[model samples]
Target chain A: DTAVSQTPKYLVTQMGNDKSIKCEQNLGHDTMYWYKQDSKKFLKIMFSYNNKELIINETVPNRFSPKSPDKAHLNLHINSLELGDSAVYFCASSQGAGNNEKLFFGSGTQLSVL
Target chain B: AQKVTQAQTEISVVEKEDVTLDCVYETRDTTYYLFWYKQPPSGELVFLIRRNSFDEQNEISGRYSWNFQKSTSSFNFTITASQVVDSAVYFCAPSAAGNKLTFGGGTRVLVKP
Candidate 1:
């Protein structure tokens, strides 16, 4: 079974289009995170939710919002995407909010804005 | 602030050769956690190893080994007899309790067979 899965493995849209990526984890983890990997392969944290509560919010733009319906699911919604929004978005989950816990990541959703 | 630095941006090695990926971290907190993650072409991030600040001992598993040195604030990973399957991008992340991880610029490894 896939411990963490994200829908729409690939997304290509024009500028100003809004799109959402859905993520689900069956590991029963309490914390979920969204990370962005740019062209340089630098992984940066965008947001984190612990038990459906927002725990970490980076310097991401307001157009980017994360919704965690429950502890098992966390989705990312990007509005008015721009060229800079093209990157790989990854969904990860851990047993808890502790830094010691290992993260289980999904296959990732590649977003491309033209 | 916690920061992890991977000096090696990319490394290429032949099969059966040994390669080492260097990682240096800085954190104000005395107690923190360090981790190494591998991201292959498939895009899935695989957890390799995790070490706490208090533990300075080195660890090895099969052909993979990790060296942790709190004095120098370094946690390095080494692969012996590397296979082509080991080609991937690896990240070094360090974090404190209840805080988000700070990942370093990944190091891409390519092992030619």
Candidate 2:
């Protein structure tokens, strides 16, 4: 069984379009995160939620929003996407929001804004 | 801000040879976690190993080994008797007070027969 999974593994949308990527974790973890991997393969954390509470919010644009309805799910919604947003979005989860813990990552959602 | 650096962008080795991937991290937190993840052509991030600030003992798992040194703030991974299947991009990640993770640019490993 997959511990973490993301839907719409590949997303190709036009500029100014809005899209949402869904992520779900079955590991019964309390924390979920969204990370963006740019073309240069540099992974950066965008947002993190612990038990439905916002924890870490990086300097991401307002167009990028993350919503966690529950501890097991964290979804990312991008509004008016731009070409620069084209990259791989990964979903990760951990046992808690504490430090020194390893995260379990999903297969990732490849988003390409044309 | 915490950052992880993988100095070697790419490394090539012959099958059955040994290769070491270097990772250096910078963080102010006294306690943090270091991790190594592998992403092959399949594109899925596979968790290889995790080391905390308290554990500095070198760990050897089969053909893979990790060395963690707190003084130098380095966590290195080595693969002994590497096979062609080991060809992949390896990433070093660091986590601090929160669940957020900062990953390095990654080191692409190519194993040739």
Candidate 3:
């Protein structure tokens, strides 16, 4: 069984369109995170939620929004997608919101904006 | 700010050869955690190892080993007798006071037969 799973393994859309990528973890973790991997292979944290409460919000654009309905789910929605938004988005979770806890990552959603 | 740097963008090695991936991190916190992840072409990230700042011991797991040195702020991963399946993008991430992680520019390794 997959500990963390995200939908739409591959997403292709045109610029200016909107899209959402859903993620869920069966590990019963309290903290979830969304990370973006750029075309250059540089990974950056976008947002983090602990037990459905917003915790860490990075310098990401307002067009991107993260929604965590519960501790086990975190969904990312992008409005008016841009070409630069084409990247692999990963969802991760850990038992606690601490540096000491190792995160469990999901198979990334490869988003491609044309 | 927490930072993790993987200087080498990519490394190529022949089969059965040994390879080392270097990682450097910057954190002001006295205690921290360093992690390594491997993302194969399949797109799933596999957690490799986690090293706490207080523990300076080097760890070995079968063909994989990690060298963590706090003085130099470096955590390097060495692979013994690499195989084609070992080819993947390796990421070094370090977390400090915050719950989030600062990931390095991944180092892609290519193993040839």
Candidate 4:
């Protein structure tokens, strides 16, 4: 069974379109996170949700919002996508959202805005 | 701010050869966690190992070994008798607090047969 899964493995939209990527974890983890990898291959954290509560929100724009319906699911919604937003978006989950617990990542969603 | 750096962006080696990937980290907090993840061509991130700041002892598992030195803030991974299946992009990460993870630029390994 897959531990963490993200839907819409590939997303292609226009510059002003809005889209959402959904993530789910069968590991029964309490915390889920979103990460963005740019063309330079630098991975950066976008958001984190612990027990469906927002724990960390990086310097991402307001157009980017994360919704965690429950502990098992966290979805990312992006509005007014731009050319620079084309990158890989990964979703990960951990047990307690603590320091020691390691994260299990999904296959990632490749978003392209033209 | 915590940061992780992997100096070698790409590496190529013959099958059955040994390779070492270097990772250097910087963090203000005294306690933190270091991790290594492998992403295959399929683009799925695979968890390899994780070590905390307090533990500096070296660990080995089968063909994989990790050397952690707190003094130099370095966590290096060594693969022995590497196979073609081992070719992938390796990422080094460090987390000081919370659930956010700061990942290095990633090192791409290509094992030639």
lDDT of 1 by residue, A1-114 (tens): 999999999999999999999999999899999999998888999999999999899899999999998899999999999999999999999999997989999999999999
Considering the true interface contacts (CA pairs under 8 Å between chains A and B), give the fraction that model 3 also has. 0.79
Candidate 3 runs further than 4 Å off: none
DockQ for all candidate structures vs. native: 0.80, 0.79, 0.78, 0.82
- The C-alpha local distance difference test score for the whole of candidate 2 amounts to 0.92
Worst ten in a row by lDDT for model 4 chain B: B93-102
lDDT of candidate 3 over A61-92, digit per residue (tens)? 99999998888899999999999999999999
Ranking by DockQ: 4, 1, 2, 3
- Regions of model 4 farther than 4 Å from truth: none
State how far residue B27 of model 3 sits from its true place (Å).
Answer: 1.1
Note the clash tally of each candidate. 0, 0, 0, 0
Residue-by-residue lDDT tens digits, candidate 1, B1-113:
77789999999999999999999999999888888899998889999888888978898989989999998988999999999999999998997666488999989999999
Where does model 3 sit among the CAPRI classes? medium
TM-score of each: 0.97, 0.96, 0.96, 0.98
Q: lDDT of all the models against the reference? A: 0.92, 0.92, 0.92, 0.92
Q: Please tell me which predicted candidate would have the highest DockQ against the true structure.
A: 4
- For candidate 3, lDDT tens digit of each residue in B1-113? 98888999999999999999999999888988899999898978888888999999999999999999999999999999999999999999998654678889999999999
Query: For residues B7-112, what per-residue lDDT tens digits would candidate 2 score against the true structure?
Result: 9999999999999999999998888888899989888888898888888999999898999999999999999999999999999988877856789999999999
